[model samples]
Target: MPEEIASRRSRITPEREAELHEAVLDLLREVGYEALTMDAVAARTKSSKATLYRQWGSKPELVARALRCTKPASLREIDTGTLRGDFHRMVELSDNAQMAKDTALLRGLAHAVHASPELHQALRRLLMEPEISGLDEILRRAVERGEIAPDCPAIRFVPHMLIGAFIALPLMEDRSVDQAFLAAFMDSVVFPALGV
Candidate 1:
């Protein structure tokens, strides 16, 4: 039955899929991940709950894939001859409004992630791991360029530093994380720690 459902879903057009995914994100923003339901998604997207379940297997997977749709361009593609330049280019690519929305969504999901192992696993696999690998690649390139030392202990903490700044700025200063904030953060905090 699952295989049959999967086969049927395969025939779904990319446009339709994108529409559904966007609906899911809208719902997530409106009600948050814990309050989000397949029934609500069905109504919002004009899709069947059975189809949603069959297409994604579970709530965690459905939510993860929906969130994945909102991901920015792959970080691996960023190469600006310098790590600082790459980081700045990344800032340029970000839309401040979209970043704020994503931050709020992540804050809402953070609590639910602790209570639901399936959700945590799904997000880690479908979303987090790819970004982590991208960060790793960026750091590796920096090391190769001698911009950062190969044995820099701060290398592993790069994501933490970035995510911390993203999550902390609004809480600490009641300010949205715009490109200016990020650029300054890179210069004052991240770059100094990396010894770049």
Candidate 2:
């Protein structure tokens, strides 16, 4: 095939790309990243393996794209005007209910990251960096508002503390982080420690 003809034929529309990405997430949720094959994704999305390979280049790339697609857009914009409020929102947003469907997906990803250096790097770049950027923006806004001191140690640890509970408690207690837990965490732990 001519280069131009091949290029034209390979061009995937944005909607199609989104559909494929959604299919990938669904497969991730169902079977997990380790078991999720490009052939399965193509079959689920009604596309071909050639199309998936053409678009994402590799399984890691496809998994990265799928993981990125599942992230809530609300994570990017969390401005509740107060540090406490922002922390609460972050906890609520990171709750187990939101992540309940992805337990297998996360486990699979954890395994993949442990086994493959390149996939680990790609996963960090694609999944973690954006979330860190969003959390940094939230913390910066809190500092600007004077809700927390510019040099507060809590500021540095807040994201990890909040997200850690979500990731840990579910495994330990087998329960979701509810509003009551969020409120108590903020009142007893976060606010008190931050001196807010």
Candidate 3:
């Protein structure tokens, strides 16, 4: 087969792309990962199936890109002169209205993630890495400020612990992760574990 032409192409505006991502997340919350067909997304967004494929190549790629875009990119700007203040800001992050939909989407995608290698990698790359990296940055700052030890083992898994609390609280406690709960967790669990 001959190579396709590379120069002449159309593009989507950032605003339109964001709208498509919002549609993807909303659909994922409603129909879930396994049942979320490209056809359905095309219909929901009033977009051509060919356009989606040409943009994302696959469902996993598209979903991953959408999830990645939902996370806050300004976390590096969260320094408040103290770890407590920083964590309080982190607590406030869970207060968004879409958090409920995001939680539902995550719960629905759980089973599919295990069954689909492509989707599993996509979620890890798009959804998890940035958050983990931000948390690591926080840990590094704490170490530099002597608020926590550089070699603290808990530092490595703080994100996991936070995620565990986020997931488990909804299941075991029948409540969403919120600012107050996270503040308590930080004071009682995370800060103590860090010996801060």
Query: What are the per-model C-alpha RMSD values against the true structure?
Result: 2.8, 4.6, 3.9
lDDT of 1 by residue, 1-196 (tens): 3677669679678898899999988888889888999999999988888888867889999899889888778787888888998888888877888888887888789899999999999999988888889889988989999999999999999999988878788789866698888888888999999998
Give candidate 1's error at residue 128 in angstroms: 1.6
TM-score of each: 0.89, 0.80, 0.87
- Model 3 ranges off by over 4 Å: 1-10, 72-74
lDDT of residue 36 for candidate 1: 90
* Candidate 2 lDDT, 47-109, residue by residue in tens: 888877877778887788777877666556888887777767766665455566555467657
Candidate 1 local distance difference test against the native? 0.87
Instruction: Enumerate clash totals for all models, in the order shown.
Output: 0, 0, 0
Report model 1's TM-score to 2 decimal places: 0.89
**TM-score head-to-head 2 vs 3, winner:** 3
Give the CA lDDT, 0 to 100, for residue 147 in model 1.
91
Identify the leading candidate in terms of TM-score.
1
lDDT on C-alpha atoms for all candidate structures: 0.87, 0.75, 0.80
Query: At residue 104, what lDDT does model 3 achieve?
Result: 71
